[model samples]
Structure formats: structure tokens, C-alpha cells
Target: MILIESEFPIDWVISPLPEEEGILGNIFFISRDYMQFIEGLVKKYKPDFVVEDKGMRSNEEILSDEDEFTAIFKRGGISYRMVDIPEYALNYISSPILNKKALIKKFSGEIEEYKRRGQVHYNDPHFQQLVMWYEYLKEDLKAQEEELRYKIRESWMMMGILELAKKQQKKELTAFFICDKRNFDGIVFLANELDITSEIINIKKVAKELEEKNSVEEVIKSSVLEIMPIKMKKKEKIDKILYFFDTDEYCSPFDTNMGYDAGFDVVIPYCKMTAERVAKLIQDAMFSRKVGAPTVFFVGGSDVEESERIAQEVLKSMVPPFEYPIIIDPRGAHTTASAIVAKTLEIAKKHGIKDLSNKKVVCLGGTGPVGEIAAIIASKLNANVFITSRREEYVKDLAKSLTIKAGKKAKKIEGVAANSDEDYYEIIKDADIIWSVGKAGIQMVSKEIMNKLPKNKIVVDINLVPPYGVEGIEPNFHDEEFYPGIYGIGALDIGRLKYKVESTLFNKASMTKGKTILDYNVAFEIATEVLFGEIIKISI
Candidate 1:
């Protein structure tokens, strides 16, 4: 005989029974879908008699009218019976033999203990209620009640089956015992105790197996190839890996964390990397992977020139199909600069300044990596850009180099010295956009100088530390008027956009199927899209 088990409402163990002893609890109604499932099983097994848990009985006291389970058997001309513990025995077991209040308090303490031990699922509403009832029954009623309620009922059901088997003059009788999942183990143990042979069938597992078998059969029937007995080859697995190369002595935690968050399966970091060593690492990584497997390279460090060199080396080392996507954002300069320019342009357009073309733009302390990239981006937009530093000669030479990189033959960028407040005032007097991309904690423009600047100008500061690069602009201000007509964008506002730009680049590099070089140009494009919902392309 096969046995079927289902989940039980644990609360019923501690709840009061209905007034009529023969009438089962009203909480035991089966859905139409599950009734059909049980009917299918009954038809397949073709049992002479069907025995169900007492809770499945209808309230009708007459034998002519049947419950849902009894009706299923009656339609097939089969006999049916319901089994449960006797009313007198139930009343004797449920008597006040133990302290119920103390048991509840103990259960509450156990719940707190489970929470403290990090078993947090006990705090869920359904689980909490289930545990409350189950624990209460186990503690208050003791072992005798449990045996009477579960074991005795199951034994009576088995006796009924044996009596039917003998009446029908059959040597083997097949029965299906649909009991609660909580009492499944107890029921099986009792069957072994009485030496009754039975098989357990998990309905859900059997249904899943049948579904999979049907799917395979359908595929075989629709196949073009001739059916034959052969073992199918297993498909190989490929992992997406990112090779992160940092020029510094150690890899930066910020970049590695972003790489993992961007969905790379594995990230291998190499610190103190040089261009000479990058070729061998790339070759080793690419040669071992299958074709079409995602592999990416990331170049990062404080030294922008060294990072660029390493990136170029990585590209050179790869053969045609093995070449992978690479992201280059040294010291976050590329993305930061992109964010700065994109934000400036976004604010500029709002103020009726359609574009950066022919606008006078000044970059304070602009000889640094971030300032240098920002200066180039402004120049590429056809703006007349000026980069400043304390050292005049160094700033001028760097400006000349950046002018060539910006692809401007007319030399739209120039360098100036800003060693004093007068220098800052004179330089930014007619500027349409003033950016303070200086070293942290260094005040590039004092409040007096900011007040002296022209009205209707856009100002930005990238120094989060105080005294800030621009004296009056707060780090979190975005498009706020610090002075009468001067709109100021602060360091923290720019930083938020910079983070989005960098993350998008990393995710794209990880997902690309072919070779992609993510540099300042791509960073600027992504920044524009992220900030304004559309790409604003600069045609240089």
C-alpha cells in the first residue's frame, strides 16, 4: 500500500475541537485543484476502500450524504471510512495536567534564544504561529497525548485496512494514508512497529519527475536525428573573469569592490604592475579560456601615464578573437573629469547657455590629472579654456601638451599663474565657467575673490575638505546661488555623478562581447547620458 502525506495546521493541536464529536473541524476544506489531484491518484491505484484523516469528514450525521473524500469513493462504488482518536481519550489527554502558562513563557524564551542565535526565520509570522502551537502541544500534553492523537489513529486506520483485506479474501491490500507532513515520520514508525508493508509517495516530487520525462520525450519525438542509444556530451562551463592591474604597491579596495558589484565572477588583482609584465599576464589569462568567454582588463593607479602604458600593453598582447574589453580610470580622474564637464554643461543649458562653444572657462590648479582632463574636455567642446597653477612655466608647458591632445589646431587652451588673490580675480573676471579642481584643503578662491567675479557665471569646486577650494560653496550644494547671480555646483554633487559614471563603465566592460576601450571619451559619453538621460556628443 502507498502512503501520501500533506502539511497540517499546527494550531489545531492546541485549539478547542468542534461541539459535535463526530463532526470534523471546518478548517479542513480541500481546494478543487487538490481534490482533482487526489481523484487522479485514486483512479490510478483503484483501491477497494479509501480511508482519510478524521478532519476531512463533513458535518452531516447521515450515511447517505458523503464528504468530499467519501464522495470520490462513492462515485467509483468503493467504501470509505474516517479515523481519529476517540472523544473520551481526547478529553482525558487534553486535561489540565501541566502548567500551560509556564509552557507558553518557556516557548517565548526559546523564540528569543533562536533570534539571538541568528535563526531569524523563527520571527516570521507563519513560522512563529506554527512553532507556538507545536511547542505548546509537545510540552503541555506530554508523550501520552501525542501517541493517542497520532499513533493510535494511524493504528486504527491500519486495523481497518487489515479487516477489509480479510473480508475481501485478498492476500495483499493496497491503501493510501494521506496524513499531515508533521506526522509522516511517526506514521511510518508505527507501520514498522505493526509490521505493515507500505511505500511513501511524495506527490510533488513524482509530478516534477513526470513533467521532466514528458519534456524529454517531446524533444526526442521532434528531433531530426535518428533515435539511438548514446551518451550525450556535457556542455563546458565558462566563468567571467576580470584582471585588475594597479600601478600602485597595492590594489585599491574601491575599484575591486566595484568590479565585483558589476557582476564579474572572479576578480584577480595585480599590484605594482608595469607595462612589461602586463603582456605575459594577458597571454596567460586569454590562452586558457574558451572562445566567447567573457574576460576583461582594468587599469587603475595614481600614476595616469603608467596606467595608460599598461592599458596599451594589455591591448597589444591580445590576438584577434582573444582581445577583451578594458577600462582605464587612473585615480578616478577620467570619470571625475567627465562628471565635472557633464554637470557644467547641464547647468549651463538651464541658464540659456546652449553649449560650451566660445565660452571662457577657467580651471584653477589645473595642472593635476583631473584638471588636465577637464581642460581637454572643455577645449573639445570649442570653449576657450584656461588652466592655472602656482608655477607659470610648468602650467604653460602642460597646457601646450593638452592642447595637442584636445585635437584643437587653433590652441583654444592657455595656461596662467594664480599665486595670489589678484591673480585669481584677474583670471576669472570674464569667465563664463570657473572650476576649482585643486588639491584637497587648498582654498583656490577666497570669498572676497568669489564676490569680485562677474554675475551669471557657473562655479564648481571639487575639494570636499575645508577650507574648500572655493571658500563660500558648500560641498553638497547643487546648482545653488552662493552669490547673487553665480550658480555653484559643489564637490559632493559632482562625486555622486562620478560614482555612477565609473560604475556604468565597469559594468559595460564586464558585459561586452568584443574588445572595448573605455577611456575619458567613453566616460564623458556615459556621464552625459546618466546625468541628462541622453548623450550630448561633442563633435571634435
Candidate 2:
């Protein structure tokens, strides 16, 4: 008998069925060291069967203790089977010996090729040790015959293990296989061909001083490092991809620019997208990439309702474990509204107003998307919100819709027709804060109306065009005393916050692990954090 060294290095390989197949456990390929710690592995992996190779013997001592090994399995109630290729079958497949010189040269060339390709595992000490062993074993005819037998036996074992794995998978049970360390790479290659996701565990590297009597629990207790499976090679970093969908005839360049600024490596813009067309596009984008790839979907358009419909379609098309982040900001309305509300809260607190609760807020020309979101946010803060438009019926319907969107128990919002000076005065006279979000270049609140407002009231104008939304309030003003006792916040000030809020949301969506939705509400929370240095919840 040719006895091998007992202190040789060993490796373990674990393969698992895909989660979609409903197999909850892993198939482990363990080394000789595992025999001493079989019970430890059983408790950790909870495998149902243990398979041992009867042909591969490392040393005489282990073979002499075969009875003790079988007794350990029996005492532990572990179902085990010894497997091997029959002597006749092994002889039938044996080939005539080749030239040793040519064989050694071929192996050397393969090792050089692997190194040239920058294979990371080539540097592993255990792998280098295997190469040294192979070089030494090639010198003798007996060693050469053993090597050939080991190769043939490994092929047979792979098939046998795969067959056993399939049987266990049917019963939803896990199996453990013990094989020689020399067969680890071959088994891994076969597992890959079979489409099994395998994890490699180099026993010698993970537990360097593993003793013959050491239990798995003791080894685990001594090591502070987590015993994670080793990846064969480092995975290349996937590109951060962002899909920007617009309902208009042409996609907006603003959103795509911000997407790149937020650190996305690729931003794909889709124009003229509808809810019907978004489903297929979402499915295609999601399935083309590997799982856990950083991806985001941004929705923007002039039409708020159409953009919302497309966003819902995106949500519906995504499957679990593949879902990415989605940001809904129709024409920047969500972020702008959040900034406006957060700024209002900051100014109100500075002016001795505790919160927006029960305070009257008048939104001039508040029927558009930005104005609508602002009104909803104020309503959510328990404010008595009044939205003014030229058309009373349209504004009233919008108010009712926004109230429902806020929540079932939210405060009611009132709509008024501000077609004349009397109507404007009626709504603004009792307001604690006045927001002008009317058409650009149009002044919703004139100097004459501004002079008649109550003292110590806050006013905000979000129009950068000439003849700003609120007359006498410049675009750069921020909480400035525009009138004797009236404070004003300008469009540029709110625009800065809006830019910060939108960019922060994009950054967060790119870095988040699982599916995240960045809507008006999430924007509001982030805005509060950006402005107040922490999130401040304002409830009634």
C-alpha cells in the first residue's frame, strides 16, 4: 500500500439549487478533516444524507479507523453510503499510458495560461500546494497510475453525486458528499455545467490549525472571522444603469443630466412612453441584468396623470428579487413641492408659529401639479388649506381629489375662485402663509394686494420669470422683510432646495439595496432632513 501524508490540505465545495426551484438547503463536498467534525457540519447545514468515497484513501491510519468512522455515523443517526466505481468498470475505461514528458509539459503550459489570464485562485497557497504535489507525483509509474485512477473515479463520483442531489431535491432534503481534495475543481466545473450555484470552502485556509479531534463548534468558537464560502474569482463590477421614461414627444435632458450627476454609469432615456408600452420595456430592462445590479427608473413628463400611470405600470411589471428603484417626479413637481413645504415649515417655526396645524394657507392659482402637491402636503400637516383658481368648479374637484390622496382622515381643503380683487382679499385676509405658484411671468399677488395682508404673514413666490409670481419679492429673497411686517421667500431660494432634494433622492435610489419608491412623500421626508439637519414629523 502506498501511504500518503495525513496532514495534506483539503477544500470543500457547496452547491445549491436555485431558489425558484424551492430547494432550501445546500449540497456540500467536504474533505477528510470534516470526518472529525461531521456532527458539527450536520448541526450547521442540517443535511439529510452523507456520501463517502470508498476508493480514495489518504493514509493507512484513516483506513485503519474505518470502523470508528462508521460507528460515529451510526451513533449520530446520519444516513451514509459508500460509493465507488467497480474495478471492472475502472479497467474498461483505462487508456494506454502517454509520454510523461509531453504530459508534464502540457500541465505546465496550462498553469502558465491560467497565470497569464490573471486567475486569482492561482495565488492561493493550497492551490500552489496541489500543483507541487502533482509535479512530484508525475515522477513514478505507480503515482502516475494512481493519478489516472483518481481522475476516472472523480468523473464517476460527480455523476453519482448529481443523481443523489436530484433525489434529495425532490424530497426537499440536503446532502453532503466527502471526496478527496484533488477532485474539488473538477466537481465545481461539473456543478457549473449542471447550472448549480456552488460555494467553495477551503478548509485549510478557513481553519488553519484544525486538529483531528476538533469539533466544528470548537473551531467556530475560536475563529472571530465569519466562515463564508470563497468565490472562485472576483466578480466584475456591474454598471449603474438608470432608465428615464418621459410621456412627452421628447425626453427631457434635465433629468438625464441629473441621473449622470448622481453617479449612474448609464442613463437610457425613452420618449413618448405610455403605460401600455412601459410594461414590456420594464420587463426587458429588469431581465437583461444580473440580480442585485444597481438600477433606477425615473418618470417625468408635462402630464402628471400620464406620468403617474406609467409609474404604476413599472411597479406592476417588476418581479421580486429583480425589482429596482423608481422615482416619480412629473416635471419636478414632487421635489419642488417638498422643498416648498419644508422651507415653509422652517420659516414658520422661526416666526413663532409652532406648526402648520390649524393655520390658514392660501395657494394662489393652485390647480397645477406643483401647487396641488403643496396644498396636499399642507393639508397633511393639519393646516386649513385654501387653493384659489379662476375656475371654482375645477379647483373644488381638485381639492376633493387631493384630500383623498393625502389620506382618508386628512383635513379638508377649500377651493375659491379668485377672479377679482374681492375674491383674492377674501381668501388671503385670514391666511397665515400665502404661496404664489401661478403661471410664470404672471404676478398673482400684486404690490397693492400685498400691502393689505395682515402683519407678520409669510409669503412665497416660485416664479423666476420677469414680473415674479409675487410683486416686490425678488427671486433671491429668503425670509426677507419685503414689506414692513411681511417676510418673503423667493424662487431661487426654493429652487436651490429643490435641486438638493432631487439630487439627494437620485443618489439614495442608486445606492439602495432593494426596491425603493421615491415619490412626493419620500421627497418630503428627505427635504425635512436636508433643511432641519434631521427629519421632523409634523402631525396634527
Candidate 3:
């Protein structure tokens, strides 16, 4: 059934289901959620095109295989639009685009092609070694090629579809893979060692062979000592050059060893490749365990347009299933945001400033995540938090949300929305602590404002720009108890926290056997534990 609403309709449409021959072209059927989302987009945006997700199936085909779908529409007539399915359409579509029998046939055809003698070739001895290695790996991996492929696909689909959804919404997205550092380091070390060992062996053999044959001495003796003064023969062309010491070319046995040593079983091939594989392993474990809710965070942009590029890059790096909290904090925004606020509170309490009961904390660019988080944290600490933004509307809405999120304590959250230098200076005058969390090059608070503040006031600028947001604080400045009465911190202070937090989270995640959600609470708890020195240092 076609759902219609009128306000602003979607401009374009894309169909993920592949088109087939026969009677399935005319019909469009999709899940209720997809349909609703489309309906909402149509009503709100009045977009020129809408991608229909479901296509038709022939009655005859349906009778034979109830799961089959025919073909997709070349174009959506009238108000509708049709576009090619994103490459991952197979996973998102409700019904199979190709029949099971046809799929099998196609796969068999591929296998047949690979079976051709010329198609897959290696030295016989090498091939045997590879086969033995494959068998050994298979025992450990515990799955056949097909099963592994399926797992990768499932994981990729889970990751890719969410990314696709974000693309539809035009939101910023990021994808990353995490792995055991030890494993990767191990591989690199092993590969390098093998290469070195082989080189040394080959070099020693050649040098020993060369050193034993003293052509120079033999020639001198034959020419000078013989009664007939027999002239020594010229040296052989091969012996004229010292090839044993040549390190320049792949002809060296060492370089050849490197190729064998650096394969997948070695250092995971590449950092990104290893990350992708580890991500797949984690995803599969989660899928099998089925214990936790999964979340993917697309942090930076409000719309999907710019974020799609980053998302696609991440997806390509992953094998199939790219699953995890893919948070895109452009410029370390969210990570920095969460880290600074959390760290400041801990440091403050440790410094004997117990209660912020009546103090005012000013956050520049407070509408941004970092500034906003600072405000939230201050409010939680019972300190009055003042937020600033360039746009009044933005600051107002952000403050309201924080207020709502903080409930009764949100009343303590105040804000000023200004777009110019004068406005920025005026906002920080009463600030007990001034936080700078804005664009890279922009200065939120001037030196004049910093001077105007009470000598005892805390001026902590997280900005690392040359002309920092708070003007005077240098990027390299860390506690060192700088400025007598005034406290200061730079980007590095927060960076340390970020690294520790990430390391701890990675370790915690590694220990989890199944799919696990890395949620706000999880991050929060982990951060707190790090602050309290509860978590043990991870070796890798």
C-alpha cells in the first residue's frame, strides 16, 4: 500500500531490491518503519525523489519461493522517484532479490572459474605450505569460508545499514576498528625478525664462501713465484662484484622473507585491516551471544551530506560487518567535550574546592557538545553554569534541553547568546571558570576579558589554537600550578584523559565475549574509574 502525506514531499527515491524479469516490477512493499520514515520525509521535505525500497514478485515465482522478489522500477512515476539501490541493498531488502537456486548457480559458476588451473597458481611446494597453514588456521577460526563470509556479511550489513540510514538523514558519520595492540605489535615484530634472520643467514653464507676463495693471493703466487713467471688469469666477472653485501633489490633473500612473514598470520597485514577483522570478530561474538543493544554514534554533523564521505571511507576499510559505536567527533569534539568536563570536576574536588554550590562556570561556545557537557557537569556539581553561543536561538534551545535533562537543577543553568567579540568578553566577566570550546581558529575570550576577571577566578581554556579561545593560555600549559591564583589547562591535559579512557574501554571491550553496548553510562563509569585509579593499567 502506498502511504501519502502532503506538506513537503521527498524529491527522490531509491529502491534497494534488485529487479528481476517477469511480473514483480509493478509492486512496492516495504517494512512499516521504512514506510513511515519515507512518509515523514515526504511530508516534511517534499523531496523531488523517493527511493522505493520494495519491489514486486510474480505469483508463479512467489508460489515456488515465497521469499523471492522480481525487479525494481526504473523510475517512480509522477510524484515518486526511483534510483539504484545502495550496494548493500541485499541486506536491507525484506525479500531476496535473487532466488536461492539462482544464487547457488551463480556461486557455483564462480567456484568453477577459480578451479581453472591458470586461475589460481602458486609453486607446488608453496601451495602445499599454504594449504597446511589454511588447515591449521581453520581449526582455530572454527568456521568454513562460507560461514566466515556470512558472518562478515551480517556484521557489515549491521554496520552498513545504519550508516546508510544516517546517509539518508544527511548526518555526520565515522567508522573505526579496534584491536589488541599486542597482537598487531607481535605480528610486526615477528615479520621483521624473520626478515632479519634470513638476511643474516644468506649474507653469512655468501661472505664465508667468498672469504674462503682468495683469488687475489692465488693470482699473485702464480704470477710472481712460478719459475716460468706464469701470469695469473683475470678474475671471473661474477667474483668481481661483492653481491653478498648488496641490500638494494628484491633479489636479496631477505626481501623475499619479508613477503612471507608479513602475510595476514603475521602482523595482521595493516593496522586498518587488522582493526576491520577484529571488529568483525567482535561483531560475530556479539551476534552469537545476542546480549546487548547496539548503538552507532554519528557525532559531528547535523545532516548526512558531509558525513557520508567519512562513513563510506570507514565502510570500505571494514570487511563486511562494521559494527561498533562509530562516533564521528570531528576535531575530537565529543571525546574532548566529555573528557574535559569530567576531568575538571575531579581535579577541582581534589584541590579542596569542595562545593561549587554558588559558583558560576562560564562555557564559551557552550552550544557545542564540549561546552554543553561542561554546563551539564557544572549543573550536576550544583554550580550555576552559564552557557554562551553565537546565536541566541541556539544558546536558548541548548540551555532548555540541558535544563530539561537536568530537571530541577537545570534552573541553575544560565546562558548568553552573542555573535561578536564584545559579546564574548561581556559573558565571561562573572565567570568563576571560563571554558573555551569553539572552532579551531576562533578566539572566544580576549586577554582584556581574562584580565578583567577577578584575579582568583579560574580560566581554563581547552582550545589549543595559537591565539587560544581564552587568549593568554598556551596550548602546552598544563597544571604546573600556573598563574598563581588562576588555574590553567590546555588540550594535552584532556588528551591524557582521553587516551586513558580509550585504553580502558578497549581493554574492557576485549574481555567481553559477546556483543556489548558502549553507552554513555558505560563510558561515564569507565571514566570515573580511571579518575579514581580503580582500573588497572592494561599492558597492551
Top-lDDT candidate index: 1
Q: What TM-score number comes out for model 1?
A: 0.59
Alpha-carbon lDDT of model 3: 0.45
Over the stretch 1-540, how does candidate 2's per-residue lDDT look in tens digits? 001111233321111235354332222233445455555555667666666665433235344555565566667676666555655665554433445545666667767776797874966885586578657646664555665556666677767766666666564556666655566666666655665544443443354445653687876666443233332442455789999999989888888899999999899999888999988898899999999899999999878889989998898899998988899998899999899999999998899998899999998978888998899889888999999899989989988888887786568988888887777877898889999998899877778887887797899899999888778999899899999889989999999999999999999899887667788888898899998888855332
lDDT of 1 by residue, 1-540 (tens): 556654333223534556575344454555454567678778778886666566434336325464565688789877666655555655665555335545666777776777698876945895578587858666655665566556766676666556666676666667766666555566666666666665665544212223333476765555333212122222343667989899999999998988888878798999999999988888899999987798889999888879989988988898988878899988888999999999999999899999888999999999888998899888888889999999989999989989988884434689998889999999999999999998999998889988777799999999988998888999898999999899999999999999999999988887787777888888999999997888876546
The residue-level lDDT of candidate 2 at 340 comes to: 91
**Winner of 2 and 3 under lDDT:** 2
Error of 1 at 258 (Å): 0.9
Better of 1 and 3 by lDDT: 1
**Tens digits of lDDT, candidate 3, 36-136:** 44334335434332322111223343334332111111122212222222346544441332343344455455545656755555556655555555455
After TM-score superposition, what is the CA distance of residue 539 in candidate 2 from its true location, in Å?
A: 10
lDDT of predicted model 2: 0.75
